[model samples]
Target: MISSVYIHIPFCEKICAYCDFCKMFYNEKIVDKYLDELENEVNSLYRGELIKTIYIGGGTPSSLNIKQLERLFEITDKFKRNNFCEFTIECNFSNTTEEKLKLFKEKGINRLSFGLETTSNMQLDFLEREENLENTKETIRLAKKLGFDNINVDLMYALPGEEISDLNKDLEFINSLDIEHVSCYSLIIEEHTKLGINNIENIDSDLDYKMYQTICGFMKDNGFNHYEISNYSKEGYESRHNLVYWNNEEYYGFGLGASAYINNRRVSNTRSISHYLKGSYLLEEEILEKDDLVYYEIMLNLRKSSGIDLEKLYLLYKVRLEYNELVNKGLLVLDNNNLYIPEDKWYISNEIIIRLLEGIVYE
Candidate 1:
């Protein structure tokens, strides 16, 4: 049973320079049409199964007006949620108001992911993003007053000119909040983004690695567990929706540019809004063979600090890995049944995962 659902809202009031996600300028006419198509897609695919987690991610979901958001919520009313269900929505400080947030609380949205890429005004300007830290504090305080506790704040580090001090300030600001989660990412210069177009150079690899280590150490010192790559949370607050992806479990993804994993096939919706509205939703689907599935399980599960269960992998996929070689090379560790990369080696996890997959295939 698919217990998770991810909804994508592809409209943003202000497009950041570094973002390459499927997004567009917010238009009321287009939003209304998009929501209508979104409803259709969900209704067609959803089996009315009880969902344990539902995440509405963005292009700034808070960019939508309260009424539009309400309409969106009304559509989701068809899905049944139990007491343990975690319903989260992404928000931006500029558009998230007390009234809008109050409406969300009433509608059963128990969690919020605020996109505050950086607290420094200089970085904000460089990224073509706006952040009012005071306003953010006020909004989060209001959420706490309204009995909402689970929250995730996104932070970006390792910009073209980012320094360790700048990152410390961001971390300090995050510590000030009563939020439960943090997802910090290094700036990636993706093609077609304003940053990329402007020929922004990434920070030195050594410096970038230092910044990553600094953030990890600071977050850990502040009592947050580095539960997964790029994510830290107070115990028991790890994002269930994101875990659905990291666990390599099947899920329903609805709306433009959303991807779903169902029936061992990975499917992504069309990125074009016009095509989506015209009922051409799916862009591509990949049917995973047995080898592909096992590789994915290793790739995704190893992202967590807890790592993968080797015994369970053999039972589920009947594939044995040459993890012993990885252990000999200090690239991986096998503690009885669990195969995990040491925290120090996690920075090179992408390279390590590729090598491990190659080595395991030879087994």
Candidate 2:
């Protein structure tokens, strides 16, 4: 049964240069209509399975005013949650306030993820994002003071003109925040973004790799577990909502430009807001065959530090993978029926996953 849900709120106060997600400038009237449509979509599709994790991600969910947020919460309250439901909302420090944080706590939100991409003024300007170091510190302090502990902050690296020292400074600042989780991402200049329009280019590959290594080393030394390729967290603080995806489990994705996996089928919602407001929610669907499911399982499971459960894979898909060669080559590790990529080999995990797929054996 699906126990996780991801809701997309595609309204942002300001667009970032590197963001390519489905987003638009925040509008109160349009947001009202969007929430109405969202409630309709959820009521129509959700089976009331007692959701364990609900992630309200955005184009800045915190950008909404207090009344709008209240409406959003009323809509989400329709979902059935257990005693330990983990409700998370993505916030921007520029917009998040003490009042909103209080509302979130009262409404069952247990986690807050802020987009503090960098502490460098130049880097922030290049990204076309605004962040005040003092504000960030204050907001985090307030969240913690308000009894919210499961907090996450993002760190972006590999920007043009960014050096090792800059990256280290950013890492040091984030590590000092006392947050529970950190998600480090390398900047990729997508074709349709502001950066791409200006003919911006990615940093040198070697430099990018070096920056990633620095982040990993810093996070590790700071007592965070590198649970996933780009995510680090305190022990037991891993994102349970995201793990639903990496485990290849079914989930419901609601709102504009969201995707869902359910009943062996993949579903994507329309990115066009006009089309969405006109009551056309679905854009595409892909029905997965046994082979497709197995391929997905292999690809997604290998992303975790715990890796793939070889025996469980066999029991579920009847597909026996031959990875002795990879193990001998030191590309994969086999232990207790779990096959995983070593942390050291995670940098080339995609290539390793491709090679493993090439050697798949059907039982």
Candidate 3:
């Protein structure tokens, strides 16, 4: 059964140089038309399934004006989401205003995620982004003032020319906040981004690894649980919306270039705004075989610190792989009947997951 929905907003005031997500500069003339079609897409695809979470992610959800946001919320209301546990909306600092945030709260959005890539103005300028640091701080303060306690801050490390000292500065700043959750990621230069076009080099591998480990240590020391590969939260503050993705659950996605998985089939909308606005986005469905599903589940679930539910694996695949020995060897740790890599091994999770998947495939 589908339990989550992802709504993508593909318009941004300006495209950040490091951003590779499908996005276009905002045009007032096209927004209304685009939103009309987006509502159509959502209404047509919703199956009246109970939604546990709804995540509005994207180019920048806060870029929409109050009227546009209201229209979008009206579309979401068509879904049967009475039991929704969390409704998250991703916002960029430059565009998120107190009034805009108030609209989200009125629409029942309980969780807010701010993409504060770094607290350093130097790094912001280096990336050609004009986001104001004070604005970000004020926005978070406003969210808290407006009675939002479930908040997530996004941090990025290992950017080109980043050093350990730079990362520690960010860590120190974040630790001073009342944030309930954080998602820190290493900077990856994807093709088509300006960073990729400029041939920007990555930080040294050893230094990058050290930075990652330092972040994990700092977050744990601050009493946050490293729940997922890139996420840490205070107790009971884990991202319910994101867990749906890691669990390989089906969801609906509405917007240009958005992807959805439903009934074992994964579908993607056309990346073109003109194409999506004209109702030509239903031509991107792909089905997965049993092996594809197995590979996907293993790769995604291993991203969680609690690892996979071994009992669920046996029920779904009817095959069991012994993990007690891996636990004994100290590479894997068992807790609550699940296996996870030790905290020290989080940076090498890809290697650990690959070995487990290889064994599962051979068996």
Candidate 4:
């Protein structure tokens, strides 16, 4: 039962310096054509599962005009949703409007995620993104007034020349917003992004780790639960859509450059807009073998603080992983057959996960 769906709108009003996602500048005519293709893609592929969560991410889904948004919602309306469906759309403060919020409410969008990144004007300029603090405050107020209770805002840290003080300021502003969730990310200089092209490098590794610690401490002090590696939310406000990915569950991914996992196969759609517009949706599919499934299960399940259910893994895959070594070394915690990395050691989780996988033994 693939009970979740992710839709990608690959158009943005402006490209950020750090973005490497599949995206292009917004064009009304092209958007209309894209929506038409999206309709075709959804109608052809969806299997009529009762969707519990539907996330419309971007390239800024809120950048669309009213008519285009209406069309987009019309296409999404084809899905069968229950009374508890969590519908989310990513928005930018510069583009989101009260009218659009009203439309989203009417269409059953219960969650709104805004990309604030950072409130620092200098950092915003460096990232080539636009945001007005007053506007952001106003927009959130309006969304709340319009009955939007579940909202998320993103924060970026560890940029070149950024200090702990800068990160604290960003965290303070985000806390002031009184929103439900926050996603903090360290700056990664991807090879193809503007930052990489300009030879801009990331901050020092030690400073980056320190900044991450600051974020965790601040969120915890402010009554937020560090639910995942980069996500914190007020209790019961965790992102259900993202949990599908972390839990290694199957889902439907529609639109250009999207990926999906279904029936033990991983599927990826083409990134080229021309190909996508022409109905050439699929790019590749990899059938997962038993070993691949085990690897994925271990890697994904350990991401949560609750950790893996060891008994369930053994029963399902007939593979018993002995991690007593890691637990003894204090790199992992085993409580009641659940294995997890301590939150303090999450900065080096990748290394721990690698070590655990290296010690895997087949039954």
TM-score of each: 0.98, 0.99, 0.95, 0.99
Over the stretch 59-147, how does candidate 1's per-residue lDDT look in tens digits? 88999998899999998787899989999999999889999989999999999999999998888888988567779889999889998
Report the C-alpha displacement of residue 224, candidate 4, in angstroms. 0.3
What is residue 289's positional error in candidate 3, in angstroms?
A: 1.3
lDDT of 3 by residue, 1-363 (tens): 898999888888878888888888888778889889988888788888888899998888888888999988998888777744699999988988889988988999999998888877889887776477888678888889998989998999998888888899898887777799999999888878899898887788999899988998999999999999889999999999899889888888888889999989999889988788889886578899877788778778888888887778777876565666667778788777576787788788888777777667323
lDDT of 4 by residue, 1-363 (tens): 999999999999989999988899999999999999999999999989899999999898999999999999999999999879999999999999999999999999999999999888899999998577679999999999999999999998998899999889899999999999999888899989999999998889999989999999999999999989899999999999999998889999999899999999999999999999999999999999999999999999888888888888988898887788999999999999889999999999999999998877788
* Model 2 lDDT tens row, 1-363: 999999999999889999999999999999999999999999899987989999999889999999999999998898899879989999999989999999999999999999998898878888998566679999999999999999999998999999999999999899888999999889999988999999999999999999989998999999999999989999999999999999999999999999999999999999999999988999999999998999999999999999999889999988888788999999999999999999889989999999999888887
> Which pairs of residues clash in candidate 3, taking residues 3 or more apart in a chain or in different chains?
none
Candidate 4 minimal-lDDT segment of 10 residues: 126-135
| Residue 345 lDDT (model 3) | 82
RMSD of 2: 0.8
Q: Is candidate 3 or candidate 4 better by TM-score?
A: 4
Error of 3 at 272 (Å): 1.2
lDDT computed for candidate 1: 0.90
TM-score of 1: 0.98
Off by over 4 Å in 2: none
